[model samples]
Target: MKDQGRSPRKRTGGRRRPNHKKKKHELGREPTETQVGDQKLKVVDSRGNTQKVRAVTTDVASVADGAETVEATIENVVENPSNPNYARRNIITKGAIVETSEGEARVTSRPGQDGQVNAVLVE
Candidate 1:
């Protein structure tokens, strides 16, 4: 008697944790990009969609000269130990320079925090 719609959480309930981490091709050799607060990334969303989105930092700005592609330069990243969105605490971070389809933006993330990241600045 189960409804037909997809459930909010994964359907499998018994054994939750998977054995290994499934890494995507884009996320290069770094445990997680959350440490680099503001870094814009060119991302392909769930449905194979591509967009140049901002990282969650102050150092990046989308190129406004009608550029087809987006780019961002990285400066530094800082973590807010008191961030409520974080697991034990919350988090805040910033990036250097960034460009994207929606212009460009800085981005940041915290482990065991909210469900997703925060895209701060964009051009």
Candidate 2:
């Protein structure tokens, strides 16, 4: 659910609040795309005169070490506390540990937001 603005419960003095209506800019929404499997992308309209790239499905990740970076195939999502179902569904997100061709890696970038998956190999 989207976060809505409400009046504070711990208020001092007898103050009245004006009736405020929800604005289009203040509207909150959840991301629908869940990246998994092969690579797929979608362009979404944002607040400004720009577009946001959303990854629908992805099978590759750029795994980086100290000074080396390599593109590796994604195996699976290891853990995801943001959403337990995401791990089972293999959805890639920032901070999620994922298995790659190189080895186990921790995702460093938001695939859903960045439209690309980037990870760091873990020891």
TM-score of 1: 0.21
Give the poorly placed runs of model 1, Cα more than 4 Å off. 1-32, 35-40, 48-79, 82-123
Where does candidate 2 stray beyond 4 Å?
Answer: 1-7, 11-18
The most accurate candidate by TM-score is: 2
Report the C-alpha lDDT of model 1 over 12-96, residue by residue, as the tens digit.
6644444444445434332223433444343334324643343332333233344443344433333333443432221233332
Query: For residues 1-123, what per-residue lDDT tens digits would candidate 2 score against the true structure?
Result: 335776544376555564677788778568755566888888888777988788889898999988999999998889886888989888888888898999989988887777888899989
Q: For each candidate, how many residue pairs have backbone atoms clashing (under 3 Å)?
A: 28, 0
Q: 109 in model 2: Cα distance from truth in Å?
A: 1.0
TM-score of each: 0.21, 0.81
